[model samples]
Target: MDKLTIALPKGRLFDPVVEILREAGVVNRELDDDSRKLILEDEQLEIDFLLSKAVDVHTYVEHGVADLGVVGKDVLLEAGASVYEVLDLELGSCRLVVAIPEEAGITSLEELPSTGRVATKYVNVAQEFFDQQGIQTEIVKLNGSIEMAPLVGLSDMIVDISSTGRTLRENNLIEIAEIARSSARLITNRVSYKTQHQRIKNIIDDVKAVISKQ
Candidate 1:
């Protein structure tokens, strides 16, 4: 029998993904998040779980290295990976927002210059959002700590994911616009969906049943 390969993001969504898999009766052992092992297996259910960085989950699924992935919707939009979004796990909820320094005095995107510099890890998402708003801006991609961009004069503003708005507040930045709301989603590779139809459907149905009860 062919085993199902599942990729799970290593951050906030990890615990929830584990819970879902346990509820689905596919995970029988305790998962150790701090372990050096990246790949885990459940021989009884013929499942392999690949633990990966949040930003790389989509890539793993898209390249067919993993049949399914659990990742935040924000990462999905930022990557724009070609994959089937099969289900919303409704976990790790957050919002993507455009923020500027508290003293910037810019209440909206319109108040900024026609072409301003914006820093973010989500370059694609920022570009698309600004384009749709008819705003032109230079997008500077950063790997982490986007809030420091405006503080250190690196950029005019930033687009980043905010779960509690605490980080923005700590950095003395205020949100000017909401880009999108995000949550964990179950995504599948197209080819894997076709080749492992029954196995995937059974897992999906099990997850759906768990969701319905929540």
Candidate 2:
């Protein structure tokens, strides 16, 4: 079999996938060395590993540059890119929510003013959510640290992902509305899934087996 190229999301999802591969007998035990580059190769299994941002993993796999990818549901929906979401890895769990200052006294989505300001990394998703709620608001796009926006009065509220709510709490914010739920997902290119069906199926099945027993 030819080498399989796998795109791994660099941050939170990296270690989990790497551990899975190690258990499945595909990754080298010494792959996590700090001095070594993040990308690694396993000659015995003909596997090539590349580290990429969570948002870019889907694009890399969708473009066929990688045979498989691990990405978060938040990023997947935000991109709206074409790809096969094969399995839910059930890792890096979080929820997409609308948060605001505690003193704002917001109790429900309907209670928000018709014309308000909203900040988020997920601009499209936030707009769609507000549209569905029949609320009109300004959408502000922030590249990083969205929580800080509401703190500094840049925006009235923010649509962002939260896992433990620690960041929001520290920033003196509270979640007023939950837009959606998200988790880490295993994805692949459509063409690659078709061309390398058996190999891909084997990997998928391996993951499913592990998930089923958990």
- lDDT assessment of candidate 1: 0.90
TM-score of decoy 1 = 0.94
Give lDDT tens digits, candidate 1, residues 89-157.
999889999999989888887787777899999999999999988888899999899999988899999
Whole-model Cα lDDT of every candidate shown, in order: 0.90, 0.86
TM-score on alpha carbons, each prediction: 0.94, 0.93
Question: In model 2, which runs have C-alpha deviations exceeding 4 angstroms?
Answer: 33-38
Model 1, position 71: C-alpha lDDT score? 86
Please, what are the lDDT tens digits per residue for candidate 2 over residues 1-214? Answer: 8788888887667788777766656566565533247567778788888778788999999999899988999998898979999999888899999999988988777788888899998999999889998889899999999999988989999999999999999998999899889998989989989999999899888877877766
User: What is residue 117's positional error in candidate 2, in angstroms?
Assistant: 0.9
What RMSD value applies to candidate 1?
1.3
Cand. 2 TM to true fold: 0.93
Clashing pairs in 1: none
Reference-based lDDT, residue 129, model 2: 89
